[model samples]
Every structure is written in structure tokens, then in C-alpha cells.
Target: MTIGIALLTLLHILIPIYWLGGDLGAFYSSTFMTDPKRTVGERMMALKILNNIDMAPRTTLILAFPTGFALAWAKGWLAVPGFAVVIAAVAFLGWLALAWAVHLNHGGGAGIKRLDIAIRYGVLIALALTGIAGVAGDVAIPFFIALKLCIMACCIGLGLIVRRQLVPLFGAIRTMTSTGPTAETDAIIAAVNGRARISVLTLWALVLIASFLGIATPV
Candidate 1:
């Protein structure tokens, strides 16, 4: 393989590694952050660390599509033009910038967060449709690649669900910090965390399936 293709392949391979590994770290850190035995200050510190570590997976998710698209184009798997890939890459970069802007601001702006949510939903729908079309032979996408797209769509959907679930958790955390953790607030945190745990585990499973499909493409 040419150096460019090899590099693209390397990036495609590395993204999932960081995504899964970072997710594991974030999950464990969350346990510490949510532990009632921990001091409020200690929990907040762990939360900060969790947010920082979460950027890896967040960034990788944004990169995954464009990298995979470009790699597929290079490998003659995609029939799209080179310029189409360029356009897609530029668009992904814009999305990445928007995502980081929201993250770095700690989700301060409601308007920007809405925009981010809209973008994610749009991408999720697009991925699901494309995967279905490809698998149905309405598009030329390889079966494994098409399946990966569907997997990505599922991942994004779960991520959105987790994001929604965390809204109350964040509020509960603020309450705990200010009021020293009432039973109601602790219950809120526990309930939200429980819901989020299931979603996260499913997401991890989907990522593993996608990784396996990438490695062991079926006939």
C-alpha cells in the first residue's frame, strides 16, 4: 500500500483504540465522581478529569466517519469523487470545531448546544439511511462497511441518549455541591447513572462489533 493509504489505515485503526480506552477511563472515573463516600471537592476534581478524558472518544467519533470515508475512497471501495471526500472532510472538521467549542465552554450556550444536537441527529439519520441502503443493494457500499455505518449510527444514538440522561445528573451534582447531597439529589444521580450505564455498555458493544467487522470482513 502507498504511504498515504497506509497512514489513513493507521488512523482508522487508532481511532477506535483511543475511543474505547478513553471510554473505559471515563467510566471508571465516573464511579469515583459519583461515589457518595467521596468529598464533594474530590468528586468535582474527578469530574473535571472525566471531562478531559472524554474528549478523546468525542474527538475520535467525529474523526471516524471522515477517516473511514477517505480510506474507502482510496481503496476504490467508494465510487465518490476525490473532491466529494474533500468536501466531507471539511464538513467533519467544522462539526469537530463546533463540538469542541461546546465542550470547552462546558456546554454554556443553549443555542450552540441545540445546534450541536441538531447536527448529531442529522448525522445519525444520514448514517442509518446510508447503511440500510448499502446493505439493501441500493448503494454500492460493501456489506461490512455498510454494517459499520449502521454501528456508528447506533453509537451516536446511544451517545445522545447518554447526553440527555446526564442533564439531570449534572443538576443533581450542582445541588450536591451546594446543599451537601440530599437523599433526593443522590437518588437522581444514582438513577441517571444507572440509565447511562446501560447505554454506555451497549455503545461499547457496538464499537467492538464495528472493530471486529473492520478486522474480519465477512463474505
Candidate 2:
């Protein structure tokens, strides 16, 4: 591989490693934050840590798309023109900036939030359809790449679901902070955590499988 391809491959490998690993850390911190036995102050600290750690996975997920495509093009696995690669990079960087902007906005940027949601679902649906079409031979890409697309789509889809679920979960946390924990709050917290865990672990499985496909090209 040329230096560029080598670097792309290294990035492709590292993004998922950090994504999954950082999510695992965030997951652990979330458990502590949700635990009823912990003092409210301690749980609040865990929440702070969890929010910070979560950015790793979120950023990685946004980045994986362009990086994956660039690697494929670099390796001659995909027949795309040079300008397309630049377009992909521009789109990725733009989305990355929007992601951080939304993060820093913290729900204040209603318009920015809507734009982010549109981009998220747009990519998700595009990948899902790409996978389906490729699997059905409606597209010309390799099967392993198609599978990777599908798996990546599934991961993002699950994460979106968990994001929606978090509205109530975060609300419950606020209530607990002001009114102290009640049985209702504890149950909501536990239930939300339980549901999120299942989706997140499913996402991990998809990420692992997709990473293997990218490396092994198992067809």
C-alpha cells in the first residue's frame, strides 16, 4: 500500500476501535450514573464523564463513512473519480463540524438540531438501501462492502433509537436531581438503561462484523 492507503487503512482500523472502546467506557460510566445506590453528587459526576466519553463514539460514527469510501477508492476496490473523493471528504468534515456544534449547542440550536437529524437519517437510509440493492445485485459493489454498509447502517439506526429513548431518561435524571430518587424514577432509569444496553451491544456486534469485512473482505 502507498502511504496514503496505509494511513487510510490505519484510520479505518482505529476509528472502530476507539468508537467501540470509548462507548464501553461511557456505558460503564452510565451504569454508575443510573445506579440508585450512589450519591446524587457522585452520579452527577458520572453523568459528566459519560457525556464527554460518548463524543468519541459519536464522532467516529460520523467519520467512518468517508473514511471507508476513501479506503475503498484508494485500494481500487471502487471505481470513482478523484473529485468524488474530495466531495466525500468535504461532506464528512461539514457533518463533523455540525455534530460538534450540536453537541456544544446542547439542545439550544433547534435549527441545527433539525439539520443534524436530517443528515443522520439521510445517511442511515442511504446505506440501508445501498446494502439492500447491492445484496440484490442492483449495484456493482463487492458483496463484503455491501454487507459492511448494511451493518454500519444498522449501528447508526440503533444509536438513533437510543437517542430518542434518552429524552425520557435524561428527564428522569433531572427529576431525580430536584426531587430525589423515587421508585418511578429508578424504574424508568433501569428500563431505559436496559433497552439502551441491548441496542448498544447490537451496534457493537455490527461494528465488529463490519470491521472484519473491511479487513478480511470475506465476500
Candidate 3:
């Protein structure tokens, strides 16, 4: 039972990181890389990747949250106020992400942009709180805490990079639609796609590393 509980806790931490990181990559590619300069085949491929990316994050979160709660309860960490707040915040963020996913699937006119922003901010806050609580509680080893902090920093850095790359892509895409593709548009599209690929690779690497660390020494 104890081993099983530890496995669950590790999964709770690792799965979310993988899912969210992969989905962010796909989102960046699909939305920002669509260009008239690209062939229809290329555009279709990007869309397919985006579609596949949607499922992982939702599935991971669905499993992670409950398992997380169970792990906390079993470990007696749920009794801590700071830990409880962090858990609750994660639960709320997971719900919002789910709602946004559903809305997008249904073609509902919901503010997905707002939800995206919320998820990013919520994740940063939750991770920061978790790190602080871990320090105060001495629940995790120093190496594990350091690993989690690095993963959290990577997550935030990815978001910032995506925003920086996407803003120019957004403008370029708009111009392509309204006025047709130009040299500037082509350049931005290529740059955005390159940055997005880098971001995706980075996230995948982070997820793998974090997952290993989480399992090797779960908190």
C-alpha cells in the first residue's frame, strides 16, 4: 500500500507536466504556424498534431488530481494549511482547463484566451506555493525540491517564450489573411515555428527529467 501510494504521488506530479508541456507545444505550432506560404499538407499536419495534443492534458489532469488528493491524505500532508491551499488551487485550475477544453470542442464562444492566461498564472502560483510548503514541512529531500523548482521555472519560461514568439506570429497571420503573405510574414512564420519546436522539445525533456525525479523520490 505504501509503495502504491508513492507511485500514485509520483504519477500525479509527472503526468501533468508531460501533458501540459506537450499541449502547449502543439498549440503553438497549430495557431502560430499556419501560413499561406505553407502548403495545405503542412497546415493539415499541424492541425492533426494540435488535435492529438488536446487529449493528453485533460486525461492526465483527470487522473492526477484524484491521485494527488489520495496521496496527500495518505501522507498526512492534507492537514497542512499551505498544502491544502495549493491542492485546492490546483483543483480549481484543473477544472478551468477542463471547461476551456470542452468549450473549444463544442465550438462555444467562450474566452479561451482568458482561460489560457489563468492556467499559466495558476500553475506558476501553485508550484511556488508547493515549493514553499515543501521547504517549511521538510516533506521532500533537498534534491527533489530543487528538481521541482527547476521544472516550475521551465514551465514559466516556456510560457514566456511562447508569448514572445506568438505575438509576432499572430500579427503576421492576421496580415496574411487580410493582405496576403509578404516577406515579413514568411519570416515571422518560420521564426515562430522554429521557436515552437524548440519549446516543445524543451518541455518534453523537462517532463522526462521531472518524471524520473518525482518517481525516484516522491514527496
Candidate 4:
């Protein structure tokens, strides 16, 4: 029990650091990626860096659920079965495998990307439902944990928005890189990047809010 709590606590503490650090890297890379003054190769390199950094936060986000849940159960805040931690660990490991497989394959490998996306949406819905259930007295949950779950759900939702925003940004980038940069391609890149940054900022706000709530627990 002592070891479990210590490990879970450490895992929880590391998550925000992992998330924000990776996101900041990607955010910085985006500037270079969108800069038309840079050579196409340089911009492509930036894009590659951004994509690599992105995997960090994405992995952290998936692990956050199991880590948080296991921590809660370990601390006696949740009344789940004793095997719950094992189940959570298994789930986390499975998701982690799928996530890395998708990454290593460069988003290929027989629907792994699709499965990963489905997992995100499924987790988003599950977290939201759990929060609602706890609040509505269908399940017993501590106030802070329930609120944290909801905050997490919001983070996932914002992440989805960020993902969608990146699509057009990457498309414009591919156009510029593959066919040589044109005025039209540069304009599209700039526009898409600008709009995508808004979503990124929003996601950052959610991360900060979640961090604050976890730390302060004022509510």
C-alpha cells in the first residue's frame, strides 16, 4: 500500500510537467513551421519536431486517467474493487502500446490511429459521465476528484479541437513543402496556424486550470 501510494503520487506529479513541457516544445516549433521566411526543408524539420513532441502530451493525457484513478483508490478515496488498480494498469499499458505503435508507424499500422482516436473520445465521454454521476449522487466521489475528472474531460475536448485545427495547418504545410511555397500556400499556412494557436492557447488554459484545481483544491 505504501509503495503504491508513493508511485501513484509520483506519477501524478510528473504528468503536468510532461504535458506542459511537451506542449511548450510543440508551441515553439509551430512558429518555425509556419514561418515562410524559412526554407521548406527547415519548416518541414520543424513540423517533424512538433509531431515528435506532441506524442509526449498525448501519451501523458492517456496515462492521466489510470494514474489518477489508481491514486484515488490507493488513498482510500474511491470504493472500487481491490483489483481496480490492476485493471487500470492494464488499460493504461494497452493504450500506451497502441499510442506508440501509431507513432512508430507514422500514424499507419492497420487502423491504430483510428483506434487511438476512438479511445480518446471514449475516455472523454467516460470521464464526463463519471463526473456527472458522482455529482448527481449516482456514485460516491470526493468533491475534488469529481471536479478533476470533469476538468480532465474538458482538457480532452480542447485537445480534440486542437487536433482538428492542426489538420488544415498541416495540409497547408504539406502543400508548401511538397510543391514549393507559393503566396497562396503561405497565406493558408499563416491563417491556419493563427487559428490553431487559439485552440492551443485554450488547451493550455485548461491544463493550467486543472493543475490549479489539483493543487489548491479550494473547492
Clashes of each: 0, 0, 0, 0
lDDT of 1: 0.91
In angstroms, what RMSD does candidate 1 have relative to the true structure? Answer: 1.0
* Alpha-carbon shift of residue 56 in model 2 (angstroms): 0.6
Error of 4 at 52 (Å): 0.6
Against the unseen true structure, what C-alpha lDDT does each candidate score? 0.91, 0.89, 0.62, 0.84
Residue 42 accuracy (lDDT) in model 3: 68
Candidate ordering by TM-score (highest first): 1, 2, 4, 3
lDDT of 2 by residue, 1-219 (tens): 689989999998999999998999999998898789998899889988988899999999989989999998988888899889899889989999998998887657899989988998999999999988988999988899999888888888888899887778888888989999888998998898888888888889889888888878965
lDDT of 3 by residue, 1-219 (tens): 679776866777767676867677666766534566676456556756765675565455334444555565556545545567467657766665665575466434457656655665676676666666665765453546555655765666675576677667667756766777778777787777778768866866776776676557654
Per-candidate TM equals 0.97, 0.96, 0.62, 0.92
Candidate numbers, best lDDT first, in rank order: 1, 2, 4, 3
What CA RMSD would you report for each candidate?
1.0, 1.1, 5.3, 1.8
Higher-scoring candidate on TM-score, 1 or 3: 1
The model with the greatest lDDT is: 1
- Model 4 C-alpha lDDT per residue in residues 1-219, reported as the tens digit of each score: 588688888998799889989999998998997787999999899989999999989888888888888887877788899797788789878999998999889878768888988988998999999988876778788777787888889888988877686677666766786799998888888887788788778777877777787677543
- Candidate 3, residue 9: the lDDT equals 67
